[model samples]
Target: MTLSPDEIITVTLWGVPINATLLFTWIVMAVLTGASMLITRNLRPDVPPNRWRTALEVVVQGIQNQIAEIAQGPSRHLLSFVGTLFLFVAGSNLLLVIPGFRPPTSSLSTTTALALSVLVAVPLFGISRRGVGGYLQSYLRPSPVMLPFNIIAEASRGISLAIRLYGNIMSGAVIAAILLSVAPFFFPVVMDLLGLLTGMIQAYIFAILATVYISSATAPQTLSSPQKDAQ
Candidate 1:
């Protein structure tokens, strides 16, 4: 049985039920990363690339530009993570279009895991760039009194990010499934096109919001004013 994002498929191995969506997600991410690395390894800086290589390069460069423009300065170091995440999320979401293949991103478990990672990484990256003290100080924006609200808002964002993507994708898939089940022959094509578009936009949103969150968390609150400079 294939795992899809909306449903969690479990496999029994040695009487232990392992989550198939999680396993598939890990595999998809590993494959994407490995393929990118292999492409880099066999690259020739002076030679022309094939269409596949060119396309991959274009995607990578576009993601790099997004990261650079948002994060700015030395913060562009986050390009790799953003690029990898975008690829992983987009690739996983494509499983819906594949015949008999279920998307890993359709499941709440998978999306929530990814969202948690982004939330966790934000603080870690912030602390790494600005000392722990500076990172903490950034949250005390406007005034120290606002710190608790800021922290709560940050926590809610992670939940909202995960639930928003998961809900939309899952609901879309459900609608598509119902339509196909009722009219198997003529319905899926339109749904598939819509799914593709939605999938792409969702991936872009996830990555962009991630960049924005990272920028906000690591922003420096200067001594001159209450204005905090977000990444």
Candidate 2:
């Protein structure tokens, strides 16, 4: 059985080859972009909203509220990035129900890329809000001796994010595959349904953890307030 979508090569670009993970990632991006354009094309503030628009608004509002609770600064600044992260991961997983479609997130490369994005975002948001000097100073807070540990901690968070996502999604896919071989019927259906629910929960967790990281990095009192924000 194929353990990763990366095993399915799609094309070769120069000497490097593209895999199922890249193909699926592109597919997800296209779908998301098209959906966004369609959703907003006929948007009118004066007229009563349609069911699709209302549902879209509800989801956006929910993301905004979650960001506000986790992050100290204005949530509007974060809405696009955080919301996209949740939607992309959730959407990719939800599409698993389609026959022959693979979730790119089930690949380590994809999960690693996602984790790296969060890793980069934390510092960028921190630098944007706190300025380079202030953000740099955060590493030395509480005591100068803690600097190495602080740096290690920062790096470790990214590793944790990548492994948590990769392990969960890969395990679910593996378990479903094993069950399909063993029973080839009713059991696989139940596993797929459970995977759908698990995928949504993982998306929430990954997004929220990222939100907390960004919130902590952007907050004025980084050392002190992050503890509470995490809680």
Candidate 3:
């Protein structure tokens, strides 16, 4: 059985091979973009909201609320970034039910890319909220000696995020494949339903972890009890 989508070459453009990972990633993005455009094409306050619009709003609002709760602050600034991450991951996994479809998340390259995006976004959001100097200074909190450790921690976050997501999704795919081959036919169908649920859970987890990392960077640091007592 095929393990990673990277092994499957779907097309070649200008001598560069495009793997199933890129193919399905593009398909997911295109589908999301087209659906968004179609749903919002006639958006206007004067007109009554259609079912599609209502569903879209509910999803957006749900994400915003989750962000607000996690960050313990306003969520408007995070809606787009967090929402996109959740939707993309969730959408990719949910599509696994389709015959011959491979989830991009099952590939380490794709998960690494997503994790790296979160890595980059954390600092961008941090620097935007706190000046570059302030964000940099966060690494030296409590003592300058901790700077290297803090830097290491920051770097490790991306690696951990990538491995965690890739391992979970890839393992799921592998298990399902094994079960399909050896187990009863109906058993695989049950596993597919469970896989869908697992996919949604993983997407939620990835997004929440991203939000937590970003929120730690962007949220204002408060004075410690000792510092407060000194004042």
Candidate 4:
């Protein structure tokens, strides 16, 4: 069995090889884009909300609430970034039930890209909220001597996010493959259900961690205010 989607090349054009990872990533993006367009095409105050709109609202509202609770501030700014991350990861994993489908997230390259996006986003959000100088000064908190450690910590966050997601998704795929060979009957259904649950949980955890990291950079005082108030 192939270890990652990157290993499975689906096509080549002008010496450029397109792997399963790239193929499925584009597929996921296309699906999301088409769905959004369809759902919002008739969005009008005068028209009654359809089931699709209602479901979308519930999902968006849940994400907004989670961001507000974690960031302890307005969630509008973070919603788009965080929501996209959650949906992409969740969509990729959930689609694993499809026969012959390989989740792009099972590839380390894809996970690393996602994590790197979060890494870049944290600083952009930070600078946007606190300004470049202020965001830079966060490294010097308590003492200037701690700057090196803070910088290391910042870099490690992306590595950790990438490894955590890649390991979990890849391991799940490995386990399911092993089970399929050992007991072809009954295990497939069980593994599919378990994989669905695992995918959703991983997506939630990833999004929440990204939110926490961005919130710390964007609003450190707001993050700690609850503790200060309690004490």
Candidate 5:
């Protein structure tokens, strides 16, 4: 009846009911926020982008450029937010891959919170773009029947994002633990190599998916374009 070490690694904070996964997530978020602020505070747009600032700037600009390309307009201000989100999620997901550390993203609750946050940001951004009234009205357009379906569809994306990440990371952790516990004699070279590759890839995927979500969320819904006919 004893809990496994893995199970014991509950996503809880202070035993106050905050899960370990969520605690780890918030830590990642804080790191990203603070680091970004530190890098940005002293930045001087007066001159060309410098190294300390350039590296961060490039990351931010790259995201903004990517988003603008998709959104068809300048997104300078939003670049930092989008870039920070990607980095934070990637970092959180990679934590478990580290020895003795469990990635917060490997748990459903952790990823769910992250996904829901992103989803919520979408409507907020939509409102900022089209105003509260306009944003809500977009749901009614193309047909009211589609409204319910659209809402459901939007909800499903967040659940899917959260579940997919948790499943993959947890599966990897289980397989690795099994190998260590049952077959310690083996070199485990191939497995270790694969683990390294998978770890980095998983982190990247988590970040990439996050960026996509933000791009979709913060992106303006244009009524002029053929898509959605949102007007």
Candidate 6:
């Protein structure tokens, strides 16, 4: 049984093979992009809403609320990137119900890319909120001797995030496959349902962890504020 979508080669560019992971990632992105365009095309401010619009609003609002809570009021600046991560991941996993479809997130390469996005984003958001100097100074906090450890910790953070997501999604797929092969019946259906729940949870966890990392990067600025105590 194929464990990673990276093994299923679909296309190649100049002898560098492209696999299902990359194909599905593009498919998911295209689907999401098309859906968003369709959903918002005729949007009106005061219309009695349709089901699609209502559901979309609920999801957007929920993401906004989560970002507000986790990032502590930086939701506006982060909604696009953070919200897209959640939506992409959740949508990828949720597509398992479709036959012959595999989630790209099951591949370490894909998960690593996602985690690296967060890795880069943490610093960028930090510098945007604080300054480049403040973000860099975080590594030497309390003493310069801690810089090496802090740097190691930052690198490990990306690895952990990638492994955590890849392991969970890949394991779930394996379990479901084993059950399906053995029984070819009811248990697989149940597993699919459970997988759906697990996928959503993983998506939320990934997004929240990202928010926490960015929040930490931005924390020094807030703490250094003289008026922070009064507010």
Per-prediction TM-score to the true structure, in the order listed: 0.87, 0.92, 0.95, 0.94, 0.70, 0.91
| Residues 49-86, model 5: lDDT tens digits | 55878787676666666667655555554565556556
Q: Candidate 5: worst 10 consecutive residues by lDDT?
A: 1-10
In model 5, what are the clashing residue pairs, if there are any? 11-19, 11-20, 11-21, 12-18, 12-19, 12-20, 96-103
Q: Which model is ahead, 4 or 5, in terms of TM-score?
A: 4
Over 4 Å off, model 3: 224-227
Better of 3 and 4 by lDDT: 4
lDDT of 3: 0.92
Give lDDT tens digits, candidate 1, residues 62-165: 99888878876665668877776787778876655677556677888878888998999899889988889989887787899999999999898889989988
On TM-score, who's better, 3 or 6? 3
State the displacement of the C-alpha of residue 149, model 3, in Å, after optimal TM-score superposition: 0.4
What TM-score does prediction 4 earn?
A: 0.94
Winner on TM-score between 1 and 6 is 6
* 4 against 6, candidate with superior TM-score: 4
Question: Lowest-scoring 10 consecutive residues by lDDT in candidate 4?
Answer: 219-228
The regions of model 4 sitting more than 4 angstroms off are: 220-231
Candidate 2 — what's its lDDT?
Answer: 0.89
Q: All candidates: CA RMSD in angstroms?
A: 3.9, 4.3, 1.6, 3.2, 5.1, 2.8
Give residue 8's lDDT in candidate 4 (0 to 100). 95
Candidate 6 structure quality by residue, lDDT tens digits, 68-113: 8887665688888889999999999998888788899999999999
Q: Extract clashing residue pairs from model 3.
A: none
Residue lDDT tens for model 2, 157-182: 99999999999998898888888888
What 10-residue stretch in candidate 2 is worst by lDDT? Answer: 220-229
